[model samples]
Target: MDYRIPRGTYDILPENSGKWQYVKDVFRRVAESFGYFEITTPVFEMAELFERSSGENSDVVQKEMYRFMDQKGRSFALRPEGTAPVVRAYVENHMDKSGSRNKLYYMGPMFRYDRPQAGRYRQFYQYGIEFIGSNHPYYDAEVIAIEMAYLKALGLQNVRLEINSVGCASCAKEYDLALQDYYRQFLPELCPDCQKRYETKPRRLLDCKVKTCQVFRTDAPSQLDYLDEDCREHFTQVRAYLDASGIKYLVNPAIVRGLDYYTNTAFELIVDALGAQKSIAGGGRYNALISQIGGKDTPAIGFAGGFERLLLALEKESIPLPGITLPKVYCIAIGDEAQMSMLPILSKLRQSGIYADYNPDKTSFKAQMKAADSSRAEFAIILGEDELKQGDFILKNLMTSEQERLSAEDLLQRLTQ
Candidate 1:
């Protein structure tokens, strides 16, 4: 028998660490560039909080939440999505009182108990944004643009952007009724879940993956046709912005988002090369969710990118490192006396914005030389007793395998150059 990580979990080893660092740096820079402030929230919240926001009928609340009874005998749950928690923070802090539209972003793990696959995880990470207190479709377009920018920044060329309008609560009411009426024609044929959806949330039937139920409703209504004057205007504006930015999108009427709270403007960025899990990110607007969860009524639109899926997409695209690399300097001390000399030099190098590394215990000349050779460093400052006595140091160019001896001040000037 062997001890091992549970199924669906993976250890990110050293080589993969570079990629992870890159994603973090890219996200921070891009989100800030778009004026999205960072918001850090707890991994778990009151069970009722998510239930109210995600909707009690959502798959997340009903089937997938990692819930438990806290020591106080109160129920809480590991968040399955980022928006609900962020909204809770926003409302609690009265963020709306200070800002017009609160733009926030978060990155962390979300727990789901579904059967795991290439893209799905029991405990998966997500990076997402929420734009609260803004109903204008321009924010919707901007959010889409930011997601596109992230994918483009990662050098992903094969990704596709899909968009849809599930209509507002009033409009969804109409669509849902229409869907139920249409699916009633195929009542005996729908899968078990679709059957449930037909009665509870018929719009979700459009998103059904079952082949038998996959048939588009013969008289299926497009929300576009039923959009009220306000929803219609907003959707048009969003399309205009996307067109001006030349962001390609598909108007997928069938794109009913997974969460029940989502109302209008559903979208996803998909990459298929990473088998099974084709979506890299997905989200939409929830115009009335604020009041639904006990906050002031505030309209909002946002999206969350799948962390595991995004990394997999990057792997397929071969994007370069995600952030600025470390400084190029190296430390090489030749003898016992010189090893002692490295301590102050290390302090100085760090203060001067150089990345320095050396092992005082690696006392052998061959071991030191091998270590420096394997460091992938750009330059090595070789300090030994004679060189120290001469008030000079030997500098070796790791790349060209060239060496030169110079006074300490001159060597600093040369290295700085």
Candidate 2:
């Protein structure tokens, strides 16, 4: 039988797991530093949770969702993104009953069925946060800053923050019509996806990556020009807060993002190291999403970044990340008798909190020593027939090449200290 991992998924082997840990640790630290606590939701939820939060016409629900009917004929979906699931959890738990602001962060794998690329996968890990209960523009800037701080901590030197405002639902209604009207003239020239979006979600036409669609969108209306007074004011304040924090940014009006829930403030963190798929992180304010998903009318804003892509960017920049710590001592047992005798000493060292390991294979002295060197142990202990009989062992400092005879008790004490 031919069996292998499903396409679009990869494993994190021991040799490279350290880099993942380092990036996750940095994200946790930065999130907590901003007064956010961690929250975890189930990996799968009722399909409608996403369908409603991300509009039914949006690409997430229309094309990329991994949804299926269970044995009971109930529709469920592997979470396509993080925000909708977080919002669903908030509503189900009635978190608003506390009357305190809910500042939560989540880090986990998100599933989306799409054409896999360098920085994207069907099952990929993401680090994101949700700030529910505040519509303040400062939170928008703060959310963006948290993402920026995390990337900077990971040693990304060239990161571009491109921000925009897509207006509120009220203003967007008119903008949507404007888009429909503008693109309707090019119906014959538009892609099939754009043609479908023309009637369902004309705003999406502006974000199409196709060459013909992009060229056709050159004269499309800008959402910034249509922002209502309140939306415009909110964007202005967000920029002011970012300026006061000394975070440099660009006001890019074309960045509508790939979701239907965003309103007013939208931003993306871009870096050229990844070529065409340069967006390392992005999100915006989704004030209407909670109410749309049957939650209280709470305002929320958040962002998510791919851990694999961030690590790739760090690698491209030649940045060093933390790795697993090597064993402190490698114990060598030369003969069958010595191998059995060395077990107790090895146990004692480990029980005392010293990282110690010995070869289970009873190999020759030379082969065991080579294994010790390859294990990257700082010290090597040899237990031979003579040493086992004498109640002493030879401890060799792998780095300094210093050797000394030490009793079992002495060896334990030396290694512990």
Candidate 3:
């Protein structure tokens, strides 16, 4: 029987694994440099966690989320995003009480049942940063700076930053009312989803992707106009910080985080070369999320970026990443006695933290040499009847084709150097 991978998911084959590792390592280093530590959360959590945090009216809760009931009949969902679970952990672990700030980062697969497209997957890996316990707009810039630093480290150059202010709850209420008032005339012309969004979440009307609903967005009221004094001041400070940090950005009034928890600052990193799937990363502040999710009333901000889209952006810009790793030494043995002698030398090379490769099945001298060449090792340790009897092995430089005889001790010392 033949089996196939599920739709909207993919395998990271060995040929591509190095690139993944390189990017992940770069993100870890960059995030850590900014005083952020790593945090891990379960792949699935109670379904209501997202519904409450992302807003039941949001597309993630209403459609994209993967939900099911376990044998115990409790509803659970594969987390569609990262922030809610991190907030859940912070609250459950009492991290808030331990300190005035919690800077954390996470990278893992997020599941959503949306139609698969380029760089979009039902099971896609995401890297995110969450800065908790501060409403200060400086933290907003710092969080954004982490992403910017990560991209810069990866040598990505085609991306641009776009910022916006969604305002606090009070600001959102006024903006929602204005949106309803503005979109009310086009309610009949709206798509079924936009029509529902109009009544429950008018702010979402600005984010509607449907062509019919999009026509109304051009004339829709901007969220910036509705920002209250505090929200406006916070937005101003965030921009000032970004400016001081030498980070360039455009203030896009249309930028709105899809999640319901987001408030005040909102921003996205766009790679224009990727066309429709242009946004490589995005996030914003959620001052009320902690209290809403049963934690202390704390203010926090974060952003998440997809590895799939990130890799795509890198490729689009022709940025080179680490590829398949080559072996430092390839052991080629001829005759049973020589093969046995080669084992201890191979073992010592590996114990010394060297990448040494061997193939016992290729018994013939010709086949073993072919395998050694194919392995792409820098040096080939050739063990044959002559070398085995002489108590030394011939080290041949695969690249230069230079050969020399060395005792096992001398070989180890040379390779170590």
Candidate 4:
């Protein structure tokens, strides 16, 4: 019987949970500082929600989604990415219609049924932020700035910011046709997957990681050259905003996002050292997604970062986490009477907001001290029957080895002070 975790899923043991908390805490603080409010949607959404937004030709919809039928035969899908669900929520509630706007930050897991590898998983965690209801290119720059700030704070340096714009629907229609024609020329030479992409979604050929297919794509149509006037202006303004904010970026015309709903201001942040699957995070603008999902037209932009990839980044960079505790007091009780007697004292210490832990086992003195040492406690409270009667406890400074005998009330006051 192989009782093991399913493939593509992992258990986060105590050894690694600390780093998870560290990254999540820093992210929460930075998001709060930027005035991005927290938002969470269900882990699964209606199958149609993703299909419409991800496009029939996108890998997420075509082959990668973990879709299932409920007892009633209603189809549901574990989200492959974060932004589409967020957008669907924003539009369904008419959140983008009123005067006020919304900026949402989310952290959670997404599922994709692709072959798993290092830095890529079928069940993966993501941290995301979306600024909805505005087409302002400056908003895109601001989101990128926040992401950069988060990465910098984590001690990740020299990240590559690749920027691009796949023109809006009107221009995409024209470009799609042109792209379809170009790939048609090399159909016989393309690998099987790329040949499928050529007929259904030509833009996807640009995403082929295969060396042979990539060589053919080098001469493919550059979407940047074909951008409509509106997309061109939006992309330019986004770059200008990035420049004013001193965010370093390189414009790569090949960055058309995987989803059909995406439009304008596409960008990816990568680390070359993170192996062949290099992107740590990436996202872009989507305008028609809201309308596609039963709401009025609303503009939106957002990005998502992978948690496994982030942990890998930290390990690669040798970023250490302060995971162990530094309790204020470690109490050791000897004798059953003293162990029972110390209960009130421990309760009071907790009520006073002092970090205190005691062993109920009434263990031996030497073993107790070893436990205290591991706790890194500043002080040790030794309670024995003799000390309990005298209305005092053996209070020793773990660091100085200094001894003291003081009334319990007085000791509490001193410790609190």
- Tens-digit per-residue lDDT, 214-279, candidate 1: 776545777678788887887888899999999999887767766656777989887879766888
The residue pairs found clashing in candidate 3 are: none
Ranking by lDDT: 3, 2, 4, 1
Please report the candidate that would top lDDT against the real structure. 3
Tell me the lDDT of candidate 3.
Answer: 0.91
Candidates 1 and 2, the one with greater TM-score: 2
What TM-score would candidate 2 get against the native? 0.94
* Candidate 3 lowest-lDDT run of ten: 92-101
lDDT of 2 by residue, 305-401 (tens): 8888888888888898878879999999988888888889999989988889788774988999999999999999999889989989999999998
Report the candidate with higher lDDT, 1 versus 2. 2
lDDT of 4 by residue, 1-417 (tens): 869888989988876777898999888888778889888999999998888877765678989999999999999999998888888777766676565448889999999998988777889999999998889999999999889889988888757999999988777778888888887777888889888877777788888988888887778889988888888998899999999999999998888776777898888999888988789999888777778877787788889998888778777888886565568999888878888777887888999999998876638888888898888899998887789888788888999999798788877887888
Total backbone clashes of model 1?
1
What pairs collide in candidate 2? none
Best by TM-score: 3
Each candidate's clash count: 1, 0, 0, 0
Residue 40 lDDT in model 4? 90
